[model samples]
Target chain A: MRQANLEEETAVLGFLEAMEKGLSMKVLSGGALGVVERDGIQFAVLTSQALLSLPQDLLAGAEAAGLPLGVLEGDGFHLDLQGAALVAVHTKAQTCRVTEQAAKLFLYGRNVLGDSVVWHEPGLKRGDACIVCNGRGESLGLGVVVGPFKGMREAVKPVQDLGTYLRDQDE
Target chain B: MTEPDFPVARFAAGPKIREWSRKHGFSDWMVARILQLTDRPADVLEGLLHRPPRYLRANPLRASVEEVLSRLEAKNFSLARNELDPNILKLRQAPISPGATIEHMQGLTTPQDLASASAPLALGAQPGDIVADLAAAPGVKTLHVAGDLAGGGLRERGAIIAVEPDADRMRALRFNLERCGATSVVMRNHTAQELPGKAWADRVLLDAPCTGEGTIPKDKNRRHGKPEEVTAMAALQRELVDAADRILKPGGTLVYATCTFAPEENEAQVSRLVGKGYRVEPLGFDRVASVPLVPGVTQWPGLELDPSVARARHFLPGVHPTLGFFVAKLTKRERAI
Candidate 1:
């Protein structure tokens, strides 16, 4: 693996901290990290081991530093979740809850349609990254807000599932 | 399309084979070799001309095989489960593009060929085993090993060292591995030959690059490859096999596979390994279920392969609904004290 310089490392740490906050959970450490840019899209790849072992204090410190973090609409930060405990510690107000059927579709990389959303945070708007949970409150993945919540059938047009990070069709 | 004539007597020298090649837009040389390799030349030609059903191996790391199948079926997508490997499903119909389906994008399923899925199955790396994929770029099989080593769970305990020499390919490989949710892999941007002998693995998979003759049906350019090019691939394959041998622990299994039908690259290469004290073993396809596989050829012009080479399996496009593939399983003999 190519080594990342100090700037790249800092950028990655900041991005990860932001993701942790977005998901409302702390990431463990003990894995490795690398950053690479391809075709104008930057990707931060964290090994599954690292994700499993990330310390909460380390992320807290990074957040405290107020590192400038920005994810362009087209860029991605990928984390290996194998063996990583993704506990949804935040309250229900912070999550977008979908039906059991919708949860299956969401995990399959489908956007969570408005009709499928059982509940959601009160103030979600377009392009807000929020945690997508199932009826049982398990974290399905992260979602990008595409439309505002209106009602049972009118709120949250479609939430982009986090699985899109792995959808590289270049091969 | 009208069916081609069957049982062409003297197919090796007959005009029928050439006529069939011209009719099917294949190189005459490839058709002639197919005729010589199998008695059912017509079937092989038909299989090549026809597009095989697309297969997807459900990523067990993300979802159960049953869950994936049920979701696809609920969406009205046509699918049939492989009895031998529960993870494999043949797509009979789809409401949307199979590759673009939500299941595919979510890493719940991967578009893979039936033959390509067999290499990992043949290796059968148990949980917590250290495995090495010598040529793992665009790592479909590497992901398979990772998923299997984890026992089809999100928690990965086993490790896989994926070695790909090409920089450009490594980029795509990393993308695929991430997409598939394969967290157990350690990507190394170096050739298999560079792996130190001390970094031994419990199992090694050498899906060596080859002339790709078997994929000609899917990739027409393979039909135009020169014979010398096949010889060149054989030379490289020998180097890769040597490296695999060096890094494989004693009594460890090594599965050598290729997407080509050239004897110089397949049987002859395995013969060389046997010469070096590697024992040929059954691919154990039957242990799973009945998959279409013909025995590896032992006799080819200018090459005398060991009889044990017959234990290896050859998956011809004609005999199986898959691209042409050859797989051989071998175990390195323990050295004497």
Candidate 2:
């Protein structure tokens, strides 16, 4: 969870730096602090909702524009910038399953251009769900990218008894 | 709007907010109360409350800041330094029992209000001089200046007199002083004005008690209080600053700081000091200008002070990403023999 927030913060800082340089872009997906774009570079902001929710086309376009992309892998994620890039992902948790489509696009783009990319993977754990796919089915295999939206959120015990929740599997 | 009776419940309902509240070790109810008072977007509040607490660099004269932080981080705790006080830190990872920590118990680290740290940092204490931390309960800035003076060998001639009005807090100050290994400090427990040793020092730090309007982040009750209550505190602040001028030696520096946003307590108090023939010194606004100096109060609405009143420093968390505070630096001109 913390790693997700940091990525969001770094992305926002980059976006603001870009904006200060006179780039005009509207936030396409996510809330107030989401990524904005000028010509085609997709950038993220600290307060915006996660980029995983972005439309597939925009995410791919952002990748092509030389825009830095933060890909959520297992528990943590990877941050790709122009000259200098470092990855900060959770090492404790297992990698989340990424959609085959996202996996191909993310890896291919990096491999083809192959700029200097610094990978930081931290605090990864197993059994984490993909932020985009939400673990309904295996849309994406585990450990494709790095960042949050893959960490575990255990169910909190009930503070108040709203009666008992009947299990679907139980008779 | 009147405060809700059930603040704790409100805080626990939201996952992000609850996480932050827990991280800071704030009571479930206190967390809820703070969130209710803010006009900020939900995410911002989460960031402010749950994001890592800022770390404070302890003045070596006061305590072992680096060592303390390392130990705490080992316990899964994190903190951030206050933007204003190089010595004051906000805890990001709430300690199960922060006060009981060896460093805290040893007075090596103090859990101070972020706004409280701003006042002294704005004062900008220098080496080779006498300094006073008036209203120096819990001695956060006193320790800050001590740490700065460490290894400089400036204290051979200079002394730091940390004066607290309350007896309990004065003891707290002493404990911190001992833990930080600051030996050159003198602890006095008396209302600043009533203390017999007036103007005996070269520099004075008055961290006056105010209505604490700016302390809502730490003390949520401040928001629900009446404005007149604050006004009353402002009146008292003026009296304290007036007394501060009397105690500071001519050519000595005096820093007036408060954790409240009330102009009456901030700019107005500084204006009163400037009127006393103290040459107002400008406090630095850039990031590198660390140390506890007051950022003068010159530009807020309803202030009738001089246009050149740059001696005061005003800090609002909303503006500076920290707590709300006001500070001003003034140098008492040398009196003719």
Candidate 3:
């Protein structure tokens, strides 16, 4: 089921709050992968590897703590985020997953929070992308990165009131 | 008991298909999908269809490999040691179902998960050390460790405490212990998390509870699990970890491992432990490339994993060419208290 926009905003706020306390977070937004925060903004807006690389135990643990769960079927994956759920596909990679349609909303929310966020499409590797699927289509491995640095070591923390941080900034 | 929606029978041939893909280099993703559908990979499927079935290794703890091989040979059952577990002998030829053999029904052998045996071995165990297998029910790995302990000649000095909370499984655990002849061990039905004191043992193995996502090939019933169940299991895992931390002795080693592929459960949990102050050891995958560790979580092919988290390990089916699994070893330091 798609999450409401309010849930997306709340989740984003929660994620940022958790990152501020030294946790790292990966959020699925608008069919892209991003590290929401790492070590209290020390490494913000960083690109990350596909979510598939993380250990299953950690992901299952996090999903219990409220991170989204992505399901892989014949076509791609399905993700459950706070915002409206999204469907992502790597045409070239023959991969797809569900995501939170919060990328745009989060970008807009971050603008309201007044934090400087950058937008960049991490270049694709020659043989890394899937062939059965086109560049538009992604492999089950397609993902986005969002953090303060390139390789952050902190674990992703679940934030309790990111909405408060966003609200305070909005005011 | 009510029947499982998806049954074990559905996964009987998974091992055959997986073996074929490895020899041919079929893309792992493709192989997994096809297996889910029960479509045999064309290359090796034909051979498997014509071969007679065989199973061996009737509890290595009780009988010698040579003895078992001789017995099987006498019975005209072709037995070949599994490359993964030398104790496990695959059937090259057999006149009857191996599990029905007198050796098997008498608790001489069980169809154990081969990957499960690797976790305790990864600990670099020596004789005379105290080792604990957390969540050890039906004690497959516990027996494996017992076998290792015997092989390591730690019989006089080494001891194993097999812990499991489930009542039903504890019975099976006892049965396995007896059959495996791992007598230099303690069996406890209590939860590992509930252990009374800190820094309790020199080593601890937590085959933590997981969604069993990777077991889909062998445990077909796993595929139908709902998302909510995954979330609940995750929460339980965190609690179990918290308990594990409290009981592990300072400077002691712990193997936090699982049988799932979700990042949240594997690498993510390791990250949490590192945040709590355990030191991860360096684990290299080059030596075991065919069954390489998961990236971002393994000690080798090292990257920016939490400095403390670096001591942990993670495994996958595609990389490992085995059942998807994860293992991380952490050495507890002196507690501040």
Candidate 4:
């Protein structure tokens, strides 16, 4: 639990900016950026620690209304379900909609097959972290793209999915 | 001639009450109280004897309602849309425990009954309002407030300061909030009575601890309660309500609720607040319109309360499928009496 460093912050901002050209670090509004490193993963979190205890006027307000952002993993940022929602709310994050079968499989933590892809937004290249949506355009989680789009083999490796929260929760 | 006296109401006490209580596997006090709570005592008692159906509230932040419902249907789950409460999905059947499903893991849906779900709606925290759940533990309602309602006010995320006194329950609270990916929730571990700071939150929710009489269908032990026990619980609830009023910003809304039907903890508590000049407000929502709820119990033989306490609503166990829950909303005064 520490404030994110300039280097770590820049890396995350760069990754998000590269993935979605319109998205900026402005989404982290009203929340302080912090890092919680566990199991060799530095998880980036947006929190209201700075403002929660103090009195807040309704007028002097800047709200970072939804979720704390990215889960910075091994090397690059692998935005988890919470993080994916953070970036996608206003402008869509780099995303791909998958079939119902693929969505179910993806939720089970499996890599999605190329055939499972219903459609994907352009500008996302191989190894880029992308938001995975079900056929109804509901996000399953973040996945790392592995080209080519039209193939019979694995196209995206799931780095984090929604089920991760259920599995990782404390009893 | 003997069966004609089966009019349970005509012979309310002694043998009649005892026989009804024994027949329903409830204590005499519980049976007698239920009889007084409603004219349809048989229906209420019968409702407590059986298992109730489960319902789910899909987190829109995670998935679209259409997608989540369609996906679950594919998994052999028989679900029906609850026409009464459009936001809830009634689980007709499930192949596995709904809690163990992948959709639950994805933070997509939660097993929230209609009554418990109504508290946050009653508070009506705007998207960016600073909301405090005074007794937040195993944070089911906190998750709803922060995720689905104004707490998630997705653009300018409002904040939730969740306070749970017990460490073990706080762990469970933390788990539910994380499981739902509910954002900007600040969790504190301590009793609300001694919680530091004041007048910080724009809205406060004290879903206080109660006798849990409404849970008889799920856990039968709650069907028996002593009057002294309710009085003891009321003392603690009053303390928590005081804490809620202390921290809530002037002009903020405070929703004090419980999952029980006890007047000692329900109307009596609200009547105390109104005695202190707290302006009681209606739980302004159409969601509760279809719930078979009656006005808050204003009088309980020798214990008459302020008529304003009637603004509180009780979702009766017999009349409503959900727990016999009680909810009251009030607007804080600029200066306390």
Candidate 5:
């Protein structure tokens, strides 16, 4: 729950910067925000999550390694649906806006075929991270680019989607 | 998968008992217990085998009650407003699972049971209070508390310290909070026993883990637990409540809730707190109570509990339309100087 050190700060921004050029601290910085780890996954948390209700002693203390509210959260960066949504709005990241039919398929844990991708970022290439969106430009999930954005082959591999919660319930 | 062998040897399986148990898919012991607890055993038995009416609550962080209602209505889904909470809508009928709908994907709404949705609000979390949610996993109640603290995610400056010890459930909790945009929470992975003590929280909510007998309708496996499992769970619940008491500020509200009808887990646990002189308070939710609630039981066979347990309410499935749940509210006693 401590403030994100310079190294952690740089690493988070660096991961995002690759997707959207010039994505720096100015665009990413919200007051009193920092990265914290839980179960080996990284999250950017608001200061409230860091501040314990009681003061902590070195020997015994309670702290929040959790985030306050959303904080444009990430869990493993690429596989985080919330983080992808945050990235889509805040930065001009690589995105593929899918058609209604394709959005339904993707939500069912299917990869995005070229025919279903109505529009995609012109700069997308193989192995790049992409945010999958619906007709309203709302994020559906995060994906990994499989081929050229305009190519007819399967283009984005679905890594995470909003339907995950539902699928988990089914099990 | 094949069904697990249901334990059925405890009760005397009379002809009538055998017929009723076979009809309701309950073991002889469960049928005998139900008959003991309710005059309308048929109603209770039927409730255990079928799902209750589906319900969903509008997420203020993503959409308004009016907006959610309008959208769902446009989808031709019949809906009704829950008598307890207006923002919660009961699904009369739907073309698909509510979870697959666009509204859910947009975080505009969350599908939760009417009873489960009401548990956290019992704490009455306000804008500035520092609330603690012990055993908060899968984030349903945590999301509600966070929204209340944020005044529906519109403003900030409230905090919820949510603790869950399970790793897999913890992941689901984080994802749920992020999806709903409820930002006033601080997640902690520590067990209830591990929380540091300063009696600092303004309110504490311990939705203690229980046998989940209340969820029998949707999950059949709940009916198959061994008799001793309830006792073992009650032991764990006691440990959890002890931690909740430790972190609660003097005079702070402590809400203890469970989803089982076991007297040991319900009345016995709360009665222990009352014995410590924690004053029992009315839940104050009587007016909006969606279903009839009986007073907490004072005696379970051989055990005669204090009358103070009556301050709590029980939401029995046959008696109430929802699950068989119990909720008790208490105010921590001030320390003597």
Candidate 6:
């Protein structure tokens, strides 16, 4: 694996810390980190390569933090509640509840618009990652904040679902 | 373009290929080279005109082979296991587009060509082995290596260093790696030559860029390539192969592959590495059942290749159900210093 320089390591650590603070939940601490650029958009990718080699103490710390530690597929990490890592996050992380109609669209790989959001955890800003769920509280998938949570239908954009990769026709 | 009135049965292979190239919109030089490379020029030409079957690799990191199959089958998509690689599934029919399926969205499966998938399998990377994939952009093989490293678990200790020179391709590579849940990979937006020499790997896969003669059936634009382009590609491939050799530990495996029918880019290149002390390891075709693998040719008209080149395997599009590909497995030997 390509070793990250000290500066990169610090920047990645800072980003993770900021994400944790923003989401008010624990996030991935140690893993193989790399930068991916597309259409001028850069994403920080954390792979399980480093996680698998982590010492027992570090692994324990990640587990305690309730950070979802699954492998990143395509270009994004997927969160599955069936797995132990995501199970902790599902119970602890803030969730945005959507109606049954929106849940179907969301699961079918569509972004969740503000009009579809029935309720969301307060303090979620644009770009914050959160768990998306149905009114029944079943976890649908992970989504990133794209617009503020306001009363339904004020053109409040939508959440960028991590599963968008699946819906993309272009490979 | 006017069609040449050459009779298929009466005319020699050269005339027949020339006539076919004129009828179809292919360059005469490509047809002539293909004829020299294969006995069944007509079949090869026909194969180029037809579309190959769509293949999807079941990502073991996300779900079991059984689960992925069952999910797709339930979605009304007809599927069958690939004869060569069980992880690869051929689509017979689909109620919806393959890419738009919930299974794909969930990262349980990925669309990949059979020949492309074979490169990583040939490497035989065991769990926890350090593997390097040179020219990994649009990283399909890198993800395959990562899946093998994961050992059917959600996580594994193996690491893959993926190097891609092009920025545009690197973006796609990162997207695919992330979507496939290939978390064992570390992608570098740099050429293979930029990798540190001191940090060697247990296995290295150099799927070098070439003239892509074998992919013409899928992409017609490849037929328009000039001869000088082949020479330029061979030069780049030489540097990539040399870099792969440098980063491979002694006794480590290196699988060199290309999606082209050029002997210079395939056999001649492998032969040069063989002269540099790498031992040619014959590929085990028994695992690759039903696919007719043509043994590598050692005597291309102008090229005097080592007889050891015969150890490499060639998949002709007309013969194999997939695109044309040449795969040569070599082992970095301990120097006799």
**Cα RMSDs, all models:** 8.3, 23.8, 26.6, 7.4, 5.7, 8.2
The TM-score-based order of candidates, best leading, equals: 5, 6, 4, 1, 2, 3
How do the residues B1-337 of candidate 1 rate in per-residue lDDT, one tens digit apiece? 1211121112253588677767767767667766677877778888777667778888887788888988899889888887557788888988887666656655688878888888998999887787889999788898888888877556466567778888878877766776566656666677888776543688999999988988877887776766667667877888898889988888899999999888788888899899999999998784223545878888777776899999988778866777888899999888777
lDDT of 1: 0.68
The DockQ of each candidate is 0.15, 0.01, 0.01, 0.21, 0.24, 0.19
- Model 5, residue B8: distance off in Å is 18
Total clashes for model 3: 66
What stretches of model 6 exceed 4 Å from their correct place? A1-93, A96-104, A107-129, A133-157, A166-171, B1-13, B286-289
How high a TM-score does candidate 6 get? 0.77
Model 5 residue A22 lDDT? Answer: 67
Instruction: Please list the residue runs of candidate 1 whose C-alpha ends up more than 4 Å from where it truly belongs after superposition.
Output: A1-93, A97-118, A122-129, A132-148, A151-171, B1-13, B287-292
> How does chain A of candidate 2 score by TM-score against the true chain A?
0.19
Give a tens-digit lDDT track for model 6, residues B1-337: 1221121111133676677778888877767777666777667777888877878889887778898888789778898897778889988898888877656655678888887777887898888788888988777787788888877676656677778888778767766766666666666677788777543688999999999988888898887877677777778888888889888888899999999988878888898888889888877653343856777888776566889988888777766778888899998887567
lDDT tens per residue, model 4, A1-171: 455678777777787787656465565645566665544656676665543334433212111222456667655775666667556564555889899888878887899988889888877779876888887566778898997677788889998887665565532
For model 2, residues A82-134, the per-residue Cα lDDT tens digits are 11111111121222333333333332222101121121123332332222111
Writing each residue's lDDT as its tens digit, candidate 4 over B1-337 gives: 0111011122246797798777767768756776677877777877778766778987765666677788789889988776444557878889998877767876778888878887887887677677888998878788777764433343326677778888778767766776666656766667887666788888999999988888888898876777666667877887888888888888889999998877777787788778766888988753343555678877675455899887888777657766667899998778655
Q: After superposition, how far is residue A87 of candidate 1 from its true place, in Å?
A: 5.8
Choose 2 or 5, whichever is better by TM-score.
5
Model 2 residue B234 lDDT? 72
Q: Candidate 1 falls in which docking quality class?
A: incorrect
For candidate 5, lDDT tens digit of each residue in B168-256?
Answer: 78777766776676556667777878877679789999989998888887888887766667667877888888888889989899999
Highest-scoring model, DockQ: 5
Could you give the DockQ of candidate 1?
0.15
Q: What share of the true interface contacts does each candidate keep?
A: 0.14, 0.00, 0.00, 0.29, 0.24, 0.21
Give the chain B TM-score achieved by candidate 2: 0.72
